[model samples]
Target chain A: MEKTINLTLKVWRQANATAKGAFESYEVKNISTDSSFLEMLDILNEQLINENKEPVAFDHDCREGICGMCSLYVNGRPHGPDDEVTTCQLHMRKFKDGETITIEPWRSAGFPVIKDLIVNRNAFDSIIAAGGYVSVGTGGVPDGNAMPIPKVDADEAMDAASCIGCGACVAACKNGSAMLFVSAKVSQLALLPQGKVEAARRAKNMVAKMDELGFGNCTNTGACEVECPKGVSIANIARLNREYLKAKCLD
Target chain B: MGTFFSSSIGKKFVMSLSGLFLVIFLLVHLSINALLLVPDGGEMFNNAAHFMALPLIKYGLQPVLFVGFIVHIFYATMLTSINNKARGSVKYAGGNNTKDVMWASKNMYVLGITVAAFMAVHLCDYWVPLQITGNVESTTLHGTEMHDTYALVNAAFSQCWRVALYVVGALGLSLHLTHGFWSAFQTLGASNSLWRKRWTVIGTIFAWVVGVSFSLIAILQHFFYQA
Candidate 1:
């Protein structure tokens, strides 16, 4: 038998970027327990559309959770109440029948709300544009074994690389810091042999760009790590600090 | 260095260094205060306190300690203002995180202010008379004259309210250090996944030990001091 549950959603509503927002309550019935949280929202949108109402707007792409687009502050958590999953990966079975869910946009000076639940995460792009890439001369592909990398280093780098640039860390942080995101970006590169050439500069520029974009400093609270869907460690943050210090003090 | 201090991590670096310096000073201060419980009629504590008042420590280490405190407070203020701006005026209407964000970690500035407020009373009870006003009663032990810091401390502790305040202050200090200790190391790039958990455990133990001992000394002095 298919399991379905009824839910009340106090979804945030706003006409435009400049418009003030508020929670507009609506009842969603018979949402399948197996449906992804975003899909459930899709059902709600379909219902609203049939009723000739302005549907709730949200950001989502690549529902498999790779694109980092679907953002929703579900209840009190950034991605509903699930651990290690984005909104698209969150299943409706996590909620009880007739549960009231309050949805919100990411609230931070660096991430302003554009519409109902869509926030401006362009600050992330700006930080990346500042120094998230390596610049090297074009050349033919080298043999895979040419550069011998440690297995431990490869694993750690992969762990950091898993961050999907979801603003959940920013939304979840009490201080509204983007340190986890910036740190993950820096660490994934800093750990590898190919990225060693521009490690120091990458750390400095990315951090400076983050600060310039109104992101707060890391207080080392571990909140970002716990809330991170990718489970990226704050250890990356420690590494970023090391790299940034090398650029500023040693260099 | 100037350019370094201007960046976000640089400012955090300042906080970490200053906070660690203060952490060390706390241990030293607590050890000296613990001497009051020696059951030796304040002799050991007075001798120790007098040595601290010597020009070598009084003029040298004392000014550096003041700078450590000032720098920590300055950076905290600066960072808090910047963080508030980053958080913006429009607050989250209803949000609650299930993850256990450390209670002290969230309210560090407030805890710091509580400790600072307690320190104000502490300075008035000791530093004002002993260092600035030269109004503290003096005694010559053996050959050298020193401010009777033991007497002043005993007098302050004898009051029930003051002793209670010390207990509260000690708890505040513990809460602050619970986060501040490991956080300092983390900011300095000394902590990792393996070490971050270790530092947190060590920090919590260190916080409680110092806090409980400081309160015990005060309570014992309040009830048993022969002054």
Candidate 2:
């Protein structure tokens, strides 16, 4: 059965990056339960447009949970309350009728608020730019099955590769640590043959950049894994520790 | 290597290694403490104390133990400060509100401070008198002239407030260890998905035993000791 509900939306508003932001309450009514959270926001924006008020601006692209763009700290959780899904994937049914949903941007020093419900996640790009890619020779096509990559390594690499760099791990982390994101990036590449040659250098450089960028250290609280939309594991963090230590110490 | 220790993972490695070392010392200390319950009139305990008082352990390893403890606390404070900075000055009106993180894992530094506070009391009641001040009365147990370390412990536990202090301290240490044990393994990269679960279960059991047993023995001595 289809359902529609009324909600009190507490949306954040800021004119620019330096402008102070605050939650401005507005009533969004008759929202379809099946509509995505973003669509519900679109309805609210239309209402705001009819009122001749500035619409709440939030980052969103490829609203199917892949673009890693839509981020909202809704009611104290990053990407809203729906489990293992982005804010765009969150359906209105997950919320109660007449519930006042508080939506804010990702709060972290590494991710500063740009506007209402939008923060700069370019720090992640900086860490990736440091050493997140595998160097390729780029010549003739290599034969498949020649290197004989282990199945476990390939699978684990793929799992780590699922990270979308959305900064949810950072948003959800108590310390604002980027360990999960960096570890996922590091683990995905380090597990594969193409990335192994530069693994040591990658670990050292990436970690250096992460710390340099003012991210906190991991204390293994496991909060990052819990709130991650990608379901990325903290085991990659342990792997990163192993990689970094091997590069810095015994290697 | 000079500058590598300043990295985030490097700091964690230091914290875990220092913590694991203290974990070893806990076992040794607990084993000796168990001797307090032997009921042989402190003979075996005094002998063990005398052996522990031997120059090598008393002088050599004692300093190392202190260093390990200091390193753990120092780096923890430094890291927490850095983490606070990383968290920024912005207070999220909506809190993290996460229930998945273990209580001990989140409150490790606070628990560590509690344990350290207890250690100050502990050193005053036992270590200071026995090891440094030489104020504990001497006794010849089974023809062995020793520092009457058993008497120092027994007399202390005999007091109601003293036993209560120990109970609090032991429980604090226990909470600290529950997270520290498995977390140290994770930091050292010795744990995975399967092993992490195994380590967490093992660590919880180990924490309860080590913590509550101290309370048990303290209660026992406070109520049951004679002479």
Candidate 3:
């Protein structure tokens, strides 16, 4: 049986990073329960366009939940009320009829809002650029199974690699700490044999960049793990700390 | 190294290391204090206290301990302020879900401040008089003349208000340690899943041990051994 919901959205509206932002309420009627949250916003945007009013702006790409572009704090949770899923994957079925949902962009000093529901996430890019890649010589691809990687190490590496960098962890954190995201990048490389060569340097540089970028320190609150779309473990944060401490010790 | 120490994680690492050092000191302090429970009329405690007050520990290790406290408190305040600013000016319309985070973990600064405040009172009551003023009465025990530190401790704990303060302080320290013990390990990179789980359990047990033991002495002194 097909169902529909009528929702009242209190979406944050801001002209730019410097402008004052506020929540503007709008009624979205008869939205199909099967439509994703982003789709429902699309309907509202279309209505605003027809009325000749400025439409709401939100960032989204690869709606399949992989691009890590959709960032929304729906009802106090990153990516709506859903666990381990992005905003685009949130469906109307989870909402109640006439329920008022509040939406806002990622709130952090590191992520300044560009407009409504869109914030600058280039801080992450900068941190990654600092030391997220492995250095290797230009040559033909290494033969498969050339490196006998333990299955456990490979699995853990893959798990850490699952992070799409959606910035949900920062939105959900009370301190706005990006430890989970930074740790994912650090751990993904640290767990692999190829990334072990510069693990210490990578850890120090990435963490230094994260702090320089104005991200909060991780207090082991576990909020980031709960709200992370990719289920990035806080253990990765522990590894980053270890790698960092080891590097400092050697220095 | 100075730059690393100035970094956020470096500050956290320093905090955790200092915290763990304090935790170990507490265990040693508690064991020596436990001698009061013996019916030996403060002989064992006085001897132990005399040894701890020796020039080696008093002048050398005591300064290191003081530095540890200073560093811990300094970074704690610094990190708290920076974290508040990092959260940005806009408050979330809906508050965070409490299920995802430990109450102790979220309010660590408050608990730390509570413990720090109590530490002031504690030093005023004990350390100041014994170390600086040398006003603590002396007793000859085991053929050695030493400050009757056990007498001072007993007199303080015998009072109901003093016992109450100590109990409250212990509770604050317990909450601080509950989050801090494992968190320090995590901050230092004990993030493996199995070890993290074990650390949590061990941390909880350690917190209780320190809290209950400290409070027990105060309550016992108040009720059982009235000065």
What tens-digit string does per-residue lDDT give for candidate 3 at A12-71?
A: 999987899999999999999999999999999999999998999999999999999999
Rank the candidate models, highest lDDT first.
1, 2, 3
DockQ (Cα-based) for each candidate:
0.74, 0.76, 0.67
Writing each residue's lDDT as its tens digit, candidate 2 over A1-251 gives 78889999888888889998788999988899999999999999998899999989999999998889999998888888878899999999999998989898998889988888889999999999999997766356678767788899899899999999899889888788999999999999999888988999999999999999999988899988888889999999999999998998755
Model 1: per-residue lDDT, tens digit, B1-227? 77688999999999999998998999999999989998877788999998888899999999999999999999999999898889866777765664878989988999999999999999988898988998988878888888888888898888999999999999999999999999998899998889999999999999999999999999988888856
lDDT of 1 by residue, A58-153 (tens): 999999988999889898888889999999999999999999999999999999999999999999999999888878653688787987889999
Structure candidate 3, residue pairs in collision: none
The C-alpha stretches of model 2 lying farther than 4 A from their native spots are A138-141
Q: Write the per-residue lDDT of candidate 2 for residues B1-227, one digit (tens) a residue.
A: 96688889989899999999999999998898898889899888899999999999999989999999999999999999998889877877777676578988888889999999999999887888898889878999767778988888888887899899999999999999999999999999998889999999999999999999889989999999847
Q: After superposition, how far is residue A76 of candidate 1 from its true place, in Å?
A: 0.7
Ten-residue stretch with the least lDDT total in model 1 chain B: B89-98
**Candidate 1: where are CA atoms >4 Å away?**
A138-141
lDDT of 3 by residue, B133-175 (tens): 9998999875778899989998888788989989999999999
For candidate 1, the TM-score is 0.97
Tally clashing residue pairs in candidate 1.
1
Candidate 1: C-alpha RMSD to true structure equals 1.3
- Counting clashing residue pairs in each candidate, in order, gives 1, 0, 0
